[model samples]
Target: MTPVTYATALYRNLLRLNGLGYLFRNVSIGMTDHGDVRNRGFLLKIKCDSVTVLRNVRQKFKTLNLKDKSVARIFCRTLHGSTQNEHNNNIHDIDYITFTNCDNDTCKILRNELLLLPNFVSEEEEKQVVLEVEPYLKRLRYESSHWDDAIHQYRETEKLKWSEKNAIIIQRIRDVAFPQGVKQISFVHVLDLKKEGFIKPHVDAVKFCGNTVAGLSLLSSSVMRFVNTDNKAQFFDVLLERRSLYIMKDTARYKYTHEILKDEESVFKGKHIPRDRRIAVICRNEP
Candidate 1:
């Protein structure tokens, strides 16, 4: 890494390290009463690259605090590149990452970048449900409230979790994304793609009261192309390393359109990456 790169990484590392022991001193009252999630403007830049590996730091919550309704935190980890077989049937091979159990050392709770199966159904069950649920995806429109029919809502946690395995996968996603349990995080996950490939030049209208961050959990190596809308040829590419987390927020979200290349192979970091049947878990949260 060059001196400039090292300096940028140090700046980001310091931002996080300061968060470790620093307490909010001001008695602020607006959206973020504690000023935990800050809202800065566009053109924000972060320097985490393709591959990253991390362990859920074992945090001992004070005796379950039955009085405490809930707590939530998200750690950005593992963005390094790894080769994946395009023919590998194991869907797990596509994404590489895990989640922390918030509390640890009880029963084994397998972590994942997306589906952290917590006392839930098996992964095979999840596959079957996604198969059935996918057909309804064609009906997923911008006008609707969520992914379900006229009878039910896709955002309902309890009702859907009991039956549909897709719902279970979705529930785990919600747990990590919107653990706060009120209002929705408002996200979208596109699994099936055009025969050639997929992604659109689009910007989601965000109505978050706090600093909203978009987490892209890539299950396979795919090229997410971000271009300066103002200058079409002035583009950037991100090789979403499998099982790692990619975040887009602030100015990046508003200024660039993240598009997935359709062709089987795309270039990143001076290396070529091939695409596969990919699944991405888009995660976020709110009050």
Candidate 2:
């Protein structure tokens, strides 16, 4: 490594050592990968009893250099309920929270009530249902093909057809998820995204719908990102598991922009999962 790089790494290690015992009177040092400084390096946070000790550590950290080091290795570990907990709480300012284990029987019932279509259909039943609803699906408008270079396709309709199974499920989701309850279903959209197709960041149009929105994932798993519109630097990513149901209310619905990213796969909770042809059913409340 270059001299400059070596010095930088040493400084970080010194700060960590200070966090362990030396400089701060009574504080814990928490490390994070989300530091604004250094862009790619870990950030060391010193939570201490006195502001004076904190000040001293920062000043001392500036002048230090590695005197005896030929090579440097940095060891990192997350403090349980520290950094991860704070991150979860920050993004969930709204009533929005991700339900990862939607396949469970209990969660399946909740999904039926709140976000997804109840009673999963068999493959034969699905083919019949598609045939029955093919007319409306064709009539629905296609989203901008330029957005995905024609790789992904989508069609949506605001009007409900009683013959379609999704129409009934949308009403059920609205009834059980809304507090004041839905006066009417405002809009429902179905997205057909290829492995390479994804949406960019944009908040939903408030004039078209109310404050609550529910979505159902079908066919594949992908990552959805939420960015705080008021604070562009603040953002979070949630994994949308196949057959999963997710809801956005309060700040998440009105104050943040949501998107499906362009990557073909994502790593969540340490497992690498690939994206496939994904179909999402999005329902909005009546304005």
TM-score winner: 2
The estimated TM-scores of all candidates read: 0.41, 0.50
Q: What is the C-alpha lDDT of each candidate?
A: 0.35, 0.48
Model 1 agreement with the true structure over 45-112: per-residue lDDT tens digits:
33222112011111111111111111211122211111122133223222322111212211111111
* Stretch of 10 with least lDDT, candidate 1: 53-62
Global Cα lDDT for candidate 2: 0.48
Taking the tens digit of each residue's C-alpha lDDT, what string does model 2 give over 12-84?
Answer: 3333323332332344555444433322233445565667545655444322211122212211111211123
Which residue pairs show collisions in model 2?
none
The TM-score, computed over Cα atoms with residue i paired to residue i, of candidate 1 is: 0.41
Pick out the ten consecutive residues of candidate 2 with the lowest summed lDDT.
73-82
